[model samples]
Target: MAVHTLSRRQIFGYGTAGAAALMLGTGAWSTDSAFAAPVLTGNPFSLGVASGDPLPDGVVLWTRLAPDPFAEDGKGGMPATPVRVQYEVAEDERFRHVVRRGSVIATPELAHSVHPEIHGLRPDRVYFYRFRAAGHLSPTGRTRTTPAAGSDPRELTFAFASCQAWQDGYYTAYEHMAAEDLDLVVHLGDYLYEYGVKTNKRGVTTDPKFHTETVGLARYRLQYGLYKAEAPLQQAHANFPWIMTFDDHEVENNWADEISENNESPETFMLRRAAGFQALYEHAPLRRTQLPKGPDVQMYRRLSYGRLADFTMLDTRQYRDDQPCGDGASANCAERLDPDRTLLGARQRDWVLKGFSRSPARWQILGNQAPMGQTDQDPGADTLVWLDPWDGYVAERNRLLAEAGTRGVRNLVVVTGDRHQNYAWDLKRDYADPGSPTVGSEFVGTSVTSGGDGADMTPQGEQFLAANPHMRFFNSQRGYVRVRVDRDRWTSDFRVLPYVTRPGAPVSTRASVVVEDGVPGVQV
Candidate 1:
């Protein structure tokens, strides 16, 4: 693939009078007419448009010019030259009140993707945006900015979800999520599974284009293109701005730190990881600061919604120690009890601790990828636990919980997604001590389409709650979690879908619970 670098003068020229003329004129670039272009054929906006990472003064708008998204070489059917794309941010959906309009060059170096960071807008308000490239008009997306810093907002509403495997099932949950009135959507990792497509129990056939596992940059880009091409998933992206972080499956299964599950050399694995991180940046609506540097991408950051809620999104997979005492479930493993082991490297741990000590929001939320509560798979004298989760990093988990209590962080809540199961837990300072005080609460959402049509409840799921007293509720269905936070209380509804093996599945709430401001446990 060819890469074209942009000059400073060319970039400045595109952002000025040239962009304004395209937005205000009825020429070849008009949205009302279709003019033929030599470089692009058909519709260049087939991949759709999205906006994410909202801030108090601005938001990020994203789109890619892909006439044929599944091009084998991963150029997305774009030419070698950089294309100038125009974007508009309007106060209304009909473009009558256009607030900001600019143009940016989508170069081959970044897969022809454009992320225009629009600024100087009113806070705590909604805005509509769209893109125009090569005479094709993209879908209009709506986004909202947070209230100004130190300002007290009345309420905040959003949804958090994860784990959407395309071959296993359809994305029916996102269809329902698109219809809900939410301020933002938080995706807690597993955005695109790296494994090759295979037949599942539902008898669905794998797509021929994605039958091979993703290895290089081209394959990774193709995987994301395939997932984003779904209409329901595209609808969800168009409806609300999203905040996202990654888990293990984005690159490979159960990868931790520099260790791959297949035990490849560190040099070989880092190349694969670089590909994954680069594709994630190219496709997602993330800011330019998150651009990948070699094999590392800085993902953990804080976002505040005025004084109502503060979100600390974590990157649990990047700096974690390898799973202790082998990979799978085991009984009474001594390696897991190592005090020096860490999940969030020392620097990130200190960052999170300082966030807790200095936050001013009414609700301090942690958008984590894995479950923070202890979960035992077997209930016998010798308990068995999954080494991939917090059960393996007991010392770090206890240290974080103790710090939260010492700092007096009020209304601390954690929202997680990884295990394809919904759970509500009263987070204890010490899980080994039954009489320990509950320090906070955790709401773990199920998957979007992973695991393929799970039941309402399973026999094993019932045993989980019986063994762990802190676990209050459990459901093994596919859906997302809807959360609403006010000054006095916070509520979460465990939304569930009936089936995902086929299309057109209706969603319903399986359970709902609330946590008072001063209380640390869940109320049914």
Candidate 2:
């Protein structure tokens, strides 16, 4: 807990709430610690404010001083110098009940971004935050802290979304999500893609920078500016605290560790990765401890929402062997059968398994970036599968799934991202046998706007359903998954949008699946 422990004296010193502070607080012009302002142009709060990584005591408030968003230089039109930004958090939407206030330095080293961690606040509380830099004030963001540690709460409601290609369509799904009554939003990855935008559906990327793939820090920043500056996405951020992670698109498409998809030199790919990691950290509402070190950013960590849920947000792309047999669907890929192949790597795999065994929460959520269930592209004797996800790393996936049953984990849910299609899977111990005992449930959410106005059902989805009997449901639609978790049941609604190429698309639930307590598989 840092400045969140606001004293009554500091609150009163600024004079009565909303009265004296309204006049003098407008420009705390005489503070000794305030950094010198340099006639900043436009509104520096163009990207909006966000909060994330909530704890029982605190949350991270994030913003960047980007007066000129989408500047070609990717510096958000800020100078090389750092600026002092002030933040205020209140229990109410109005600043009249302000509880915490502080200043943080937005440095050029981190692309003028600021993340001020507020701590020592009361647990299980809702707070509103905003940022002030130069003469500009940011929009207010709503955030909620987790229930007190070890306390079992009544229920938890949240949503998970992924894969919003800016060129594909608008973030209309996010607009609907922003209005939902939820506790937290988990971004499972693909926050931004790496490729250039050409013949775009939305027709907004006219900049020449959009003609080239993002390779350096500046280009990545420009890409983020294009996406994060969207009003709907920003509204989603301002609506609730987010648990964010990057999949392949944040760096490169289908990237495996330092191995680039186009087979670039390891050294070359590392530079690009470092730039991508830094850009993600700069723009996301993450803790300071999550800052990247070179090409390495440890994103696999556990967060507890009282004793109701344990969310283990994973990094599937950072520590995986390159996809075998050229990384696509193949009928007979001998390299994938190797037991050494892994998606979670060694340490992360072990860490997740251990946490599962000892976790006290009722539901153990693997906030994965890709599918964990086996999806056979072709049925019959010879197995055909995509060599990207856990299906490509069979032994490791089996080991993790088997241990969950062995450890007697209460409720296991693998909420996954990627593949712009919805799937509710009954995860079996062995996919080769149709009768293998069901061990858990894996809910694969479709994209926010990735596949560009997908249909309700497709030929590929039909083939998958026919090939995998354990697959309970499949819908090729564009939207997110709204989930509700309680002591006895967990429900997922496959919320879909008819179209996203334009804007103002209403969402509807295509299907719903329920996983009852003590039951491992799904019930449609």
Q: lDDT of each structure? A: 0.85, 0.86
lDDT of 1 by residue, 437-510 (tens): 99999999999989989998899898897778788899999999999899998999999998999889899999
Give me the candidate number with maximum TM-score: 2
Off by over 4 Å in 2: 1-34
Residue-level lDDT for 109 in candidate 2: 67
Tell me which residue pairs clash in candidate 2: 1-119
Candidate 2 lDDT for residue 263: 86
TM-score of 1: 0.92
For 1-524, candidate 2 gives per-residue lDDT tens digits of 11323343332223444322222221222235556876887889899889999999989888878888789998999987757788999999988899998887676767788777888778889999998888888999999999999899989999999999999999999999999999999999999998888668785647787688899999999999988889999999999999999899999999998689988877677778888988998899988667666677889999999999999998898889989988988878888878898888899989998998888988999999889999987757767898999888888888888999898788889999999999998989988676789999999999988879899999989889888889999998899999999999999999999999999999999998999988999999
- Give the local distance difference test score of model 1: 0.85
